[model samples]
Target: MPDWKTTYAHFLDTAKTAYTANEQRGDLLVQGELALAKVTVDVASNDITNIEREEELTLYFQMKQLLNILRAIYNDQFDMQPEKEDALVAAVLYFVSPFDAIPDDAPLGLFDDAQVIDFVHEQLASDIDRFHHEM
Candidate 1:
């Protein structure tokens, strides 16, 4: 198996490149739809009782919110610059990807997802905050 950390790092770098290019060449909306669908299914299939720690719960919620924001962007409910849109799409792709730094079934696996979301959120904080205000 490939090193998960290396894969994660490579994806991040790809996201950065996509963001800087400010072009939407790939099927970002399609990817976003698939990612959101998986997230919705995961949420519906799993019970919240397994979450024991407050921090873990917080991370879960944060990822959910990030996903929602990405969905809105994908659905054209919110408009953004090409760069921002590309960046957000890249982040969502990372979250939906299976080859995470930690497997999703592993203990605290979703933490890696949260970290990726946090990184993206930090990068696009201003735009996201503005969108929230507009909504």
Candidate 2:
């Protein structure tokens, strides 16, 4: 796998994967983006050094861009499946909470995202019962 920069660039460059993934559920794109956003937040909250301002700033910018992409994907996907929109939104919010296995101020900033993404992917792939349960 390439570095995070390359991987990030690749993901930012296209919507094809999301489009294809959403064909069945029609909301996979939004769910994916929501999942990404939640994961990004998890990563961001784990900054350990107050002195490494540059790194934090870079991450913040990346987070902003990722958030925009997620909003777009979510909005588009949400329009297609209004029935489960509420549930999807709830799940995204659930993951966005300031709670994770690691403290937000840990040295490994992006660690939480990996775990969160795995969970999000699982949830998004499964039924809506879990989402509704959160409500």
Candidate 3:
């Protein structure tokens, strides 16, 4: 397997590039958010009951939590520095991009997305804590 940390780092850069594109970034993120929603629904409908791995469950939860946090930021329910905000947006946008470190169609495809979210959460731990506390 490839180095997830490095791969996720590249994802952040890609996401930042897209986010810096203004209106197009908004459209891309919307598409990503919708894709995440669809995946959430699919998991709830079938795979939720079948998921037996602890790691998988943890990743899924992180994906949901970070996405929620990202939504709060976008909705103005939370605040973050522009750089961190851009990173957060980039992490979320990974959901819509098919050409990522790991193909979204492969087994455990979302592993990369979840890891990126976790890394962002760690890097912005205080900001996330503030978001939780302020909300």
Candidate 4:
């Protein structure tokens, strides 16, 4: 397995580039999120026995939470620091790329995504808690 840190840095760079492209990046964020959901559903419905059901469910929950936060920020319904917003978007952009650290076809591929989301979740813990409370 390669170092996830290097892969994560690459994701961050990709995200920054896409984010500043003068497009409707918020729309891109939503599309990226929906893609992740569809992929997860496809993986879940398959009969791959080695999958850890509990962990996958937990990852799905985190993905939903991140989407909610990003939506709230873009909709002007929630307040978060600028730095945290960058981290959140970077994590979401990981999904938009068809290429993964491990291809999505692998039974455990989403775990790489899980790693990014988990790290971002921790990074934004306070904001997430506040978002839950205030919004």
lDDT of each: 0.62, 0.40, 0.67, 0.73
- All candidates in order of lDDT, best leading: 4, 3, 1, 2
* Alpha carbon lDDT at 132, candidate 2: 32
Please identify model 4 stretches exceeding 4 Å from their true place. 20-23, 39-46, 49-51
Q: Using Cα atoms with residue i matched to residue i, what is each candidate's TM-score against the true structure? A: 0.60, 0.30, 0.71, 0.83
Candidate 1 lDDT by residue in tens digits, 1-135: 345446556775676675443234236545555655655555555454444344455555655666567556656677777666655666666666666777767765666766776776787888878878977
- Model 4 TM-score, all chains together: 0.83
Model 3: colliding residue pairs = none
Clashes of each: 0, 1, 0, 0
TM-score of 2: 0.30
Please tell me which model should have the higher TM-score, number 2 or number 3.
3
lDDT of 1: 0.62
Model 4 Cα lDDT, one tens digit per residue, 1-135: 555566777877766666754255677666867776775775577554545666677677887888888878777798777667768788787755556676656767777877888999899989989989998
By lDDT, is 2 or 4 better?
4
Q: Looking at model 1, which ten-residue stretch has the lowest summed lDDT? A: 19-28
> Candidates 3 and 4: which is better by lDDT?
4
